[model samples]
Target: MTSTGEGPSATGSSSISANTSQISLADQFARSTEEEIQFALDEIRNENDKLEKETGILTKYLKRVDPKDIQTQIKGLEASPVQQDVVRVHKRRSRSRTGSTERLLKLTTEQKCDIAQREHDELREEINKFKHETEKILDTYRATREEAEIRLAEMKKSSYEFNRDIVLGAKNLRTGRVVAERVTRYFEDKMRSRKALIEKLRLKNSTLKVQKKKLQLQLKQKEEMGEVLHEVDFKQLRIENNQYLEKIDERNQELLKLKHSSGNTLQVLNTYKKKLNNLTMESNRLKLEISQRNELLTKIDKETELVEKEREKAESINANLRRQLQDYIVPEVLDYVQVRADLYELTKTMKTWERKVDIAQMELQKYQKQWLMMREHNRTVNPWATMEQHAAL
Candidate 1:
């Protein structure tokens, strides 16, 4: 039996080995696929970097323009006054045919000066206009510089935010990949284990089926032997039946005696039932008394609850009264006492102020007396008659 079991076990193990080999092959395929995806992502990143650099360079070139250079070129064109002078000189020569060559040449100098002066005035006006225009250009350049600075700041901030998001996204992607890989590996391993178990079960089932066939053959052989044994048992059962019939007759007599005793026992059971009925009535009476007591207890509980509620209400009222006494009565008394005390202190202060005023009056009188005495002394030292004589001279 052990040898037979070993044969099936060996077959089951072989099936598991085959399944594990297939799972290993599948794992290799998955790893290869991941490597390819990573390579593609890296290539795309390189291309994106190259494109961004090119775009940045092109944008800088397009924005590069010097406003001062444009202003300098316009000023140079405006400064050339030679053409205007030549035109004025030719016109004068054409109009003065009777004039001498020296006179015409002399007139040319005066005309050139006059023309140059007018050109200078015009150029000054143009310069003024250019200055006004250049002011506007400078204002526009300043605004553009500010806007570009703001845009650059915004772009840098956006780039930082985008890079942060990219970093977070990359981290999430890496984490997801790791989790997915682990899950895939776990499931693959589970599937391999299941396949191995299923193969083992299949082998066990096959062995069981073979054992069932063998059991069926053994059962057939046992059935044939059982038929002969059953015939011998039948003859013995017939002999035993005859002896059992005699024993049953004796048992029937004993049953008759038991029936008589049972009838007497029935009478005793009826007597006990009467007593049980009386006890039941008493028990019912006691149950009614208990129910009445329970009702009384319930009523008492309800009254106690009412009393408790009233006590709580009284406590709340007392607490409210105490709070009202503290809020209104005590503070009002204290306020009145404080006001009386302040009035008494104010009265004392007024008395002290009156005494100080009287002392000040006395000091003022003493000063007035001294001032009068000094005036008398001054009059004696310098006589009024001498002062009047000096004033007259």
Candidate 2:
């Protein structure tokens, strides 16, 4: 019996081929993924740089549009009550509002970065999803390849057995033909499925390429818009310069008005000076009166001191008399005097209490009379109650 075992060289060659194909596939996937990621990063960085440059340019342009001097002039002009120029104030307010609106419309670097970052995150998530999907597909393909390898091994064994059987005249030619047909049909279906999968991958790749192109175009358009914005900034600056010149002129007119008013102010100052001189004369007279009043107050204070001393002497005499009355008087006499005083106070308090009691009694009698009248009215209104009261009596 002849052995149909595969040679070592043939097995090694097949394994080598399989390893090389797998390495090529892995390398292609890695290169493609890296290129896409690098491309996206480069695009994002370029956009960021452009946005920074534009933001800086805009900020500088806005700074140049109106200087501090112009704003100060406008503020001073607005505050000039002498000129109450409503038109100028309104114009300034409107300009300020417009400038604020323009500033609001201009995106800051941080804001631009936030939008870019959001887009980047979304794109990154999409890339991650695509990578996950690709990995899943690759895993499925790997599993399918393993299954096919196993099936091939089974087929090889079956084919060897079939060939051996044929050589021994055990298997018929019709059976071999049926086995060959089944193998051909299985390979044809596998090829068709693989071709469809490849076509789908190609379609997806083409769509991604188109999307990338669209993104590139959008970036270009954004750069062009930045240029247009710069131009608009220049135009706006020019307009603002003109407005500033107009404001300077208005300020000069206000200065002229102020100069004219300064003359009137000088005349008013002279009148104020004259009044101040009169007030000084009046103040000197008042100062003299104040001095006279101060002298009179000193004299009154001296008299008050003499009166206070006399009052002190009188208080001392009274205090001495009170001490004599307390110490020299007999205890019985003192007690009689104290009792008499207490009796008098008690009688006064009793008289007040009696008056209160009399007023209270009179109020009570009035209330009683009102109650009697109310009861009589009730009895007259309700004759049945009156009859019941009489029956109870």
Candidate 3:
């Protein structure tokens, strides 16, 4: 129970410390920008300082490692004779424990420090290189952003002026709407100067046009009063009249073509009228045929009904006669012969009725085919009335 309680307490304390450290780191990140480049530089400097102190310690420890002892050991090993591998190993182990262990420990610690220092120097170089690259990127981005902002401002100003001037329009126009914004003094003066020049040019143009007309009138008056027109003027008139004459010729040709087309259109209309009349006559004939066929079918149905009644009567009479013959022996041969004749006649009549029924079925099928043909014709000729006619049927 105590262990569990202590575990929770320890964990809670560690979590609180971690939270505090994280909050501090977040504060550092939030405050420092250039994407925390200065913070990274500070970290790099701290790491480099640590590496320098370690390098200094290593230098001091390296001084304690005697080069003379290492040289003497190397010479001794070289001078030794060839020996068995087990004996050599035993000797080497003994020497390591008694003589070289301390020196080896010092050398290993120095090597570790050197490696650490070299790694730190490389990391520092890479950090500086990355810092320069990031600074270059950020600097270029800021410069470009500032330039773009200036251009945007200029464009916005120009756009405002364009919209204002266009929407304001000219006061001389019919709309009575007023300009929403006042012009600057420079623009106002510039507009006034341009308007004055425009007015002067407009008056000059009007006067020049009037003078030209006056000169033309005088020339015409001179020509009409006393002088003949120049050959150049006659040539100009001839040219203008020739253009109108060509257009008139073209229009006359078009009129002839239109008249021919109208005649063809009339011919086509007459042909269609004659065809429609023929179709109307044929449709009337078909309708008459359909009515006649319907009357014939009605008559056939009535004949069939009469035949059925006659068959029923004959059958009843024959049944009664047979019953009588069977119950009482016939005294007359003539009566039996009459009964047989009556039975033969009934069979014959039944065969006739059956043949009539077969004929009626064939007629019905033929009528259905004719009706279908008529329906198809109606669909082709009088499409709007087909459904109504079919429903009536």
Candidate 4:
């Protein structure tokens, strides 16, 4: 029996050891998983950094080639006269005078060589410029490709991280669920006790809810009663206010009557004031007319003096005219005709000035009438007058 028990116990011990080993192995695997994820993240960061450095260097190299230099070289090549041909004609006549022979003079060998050398230099510069530009373009394209690759790698790394996080979270959730299940299994007695307590709490909550509902109903009833009371009070207050307002209205009616009477008195006073002002204005106008009459008398005195002088001048002119008539000059008739035409033009100018004055006076009278009508309308609809009535009330 001892041997049999030992054998069974040994088997049990082996099983326990195996289980411990499995747990350790799982722990090691989890640690390795975390380390591998960290390693992957680091590798991605290092790769990204390397790609960025390379891209930066390539971009700098591309920027070093100036496109303006290439354009300037092209322009210089186009402007070079050596690229164009000019023809010159030479004529030679023999001493025998048979005819003229025309020959075209071409550029000399040295000149042609110089032009070719210049052309070669221009072509070389253009070619070199184009080569540099092409290299710059290629460098840019390569840098762009590298940047895109780097970005793609970064996106892949982020995707991997996201997937890893989801996996880790799921694992943690599963572990939590296992732990929770183990705790529930270990505390079955306590769970029953807690269940009873929860049931009691649920019953208590239900009862409390019913009590709260009853309280709410009571509160609603109280609120309704309070609202009814408030309404009754509001109605009573409104009735009282209405009675007071009626009395006030009666007083206001009396006040309005007084105000109307006062307004009538003010209107009468204003009318008397206006009449007094009109009388004063008439007196002032009369004074002004007297002053104007005096000025006119002075003007008349000056005109009399002027007319006297003009008459003397006319008499002298008449004497000269009579003398001229006696001389019997036909040119004198032309002078008399021009004098008559000038007098007619002066008379027409005076008539035009008089017509303009009459038109201006008519326009002024129309404006005055419009202004007076607008004033009367404003007095009837003035907001200030209404405000004053309200204030008095």
Model 4 CA deviation exceeding 4 Å by range: 1-103, 171-393
Q: Report lDDT (CA) for all predictions.
A: 0.69, 0.72, 0.71, 0.69
* lDDT by residue (tens digit), candidate 2, 304-372: 999999999999999999998888945588899999999999999999999999999999999999999
* Residue 119 displacement (Å), model 3: 99
* Ten-residue region with minimum lDDT total, candidate 2: 97-106
Stretches of model 2 off by over 4 angstroms after superposition: 1-104, 169-393
Report the lDDT tens digits of candidate 4 across residue range 151-266. Answer: 99977976675455443433456454334444444357556867998999999999999999999998899897874366678899999999999999999999999999999999
RMSD of each: 60.7, 42.8, 45.2, 53.9
RMSD of 1: 60.7
Cα misplacement distance, residue 37 of candidate 2 (Å): 36
Query: RMSD in Å for candidate 3, one decimal?
Result: 45.2
Candidate order, TM-score descending = 3, 4, 2, 1
Question: Of models 1 and 3, which has the larger TM-score?
Answer: 3
lDDT of 1 at 370: 100
**Could you estimate the TM-score for every candidate?**
0.19, 0.20, 0.25, 0.20
Candidate 3's TM-score: 0.25
Candidate 3 deviant stretches above 4 angstroms: 1-238, 330-393
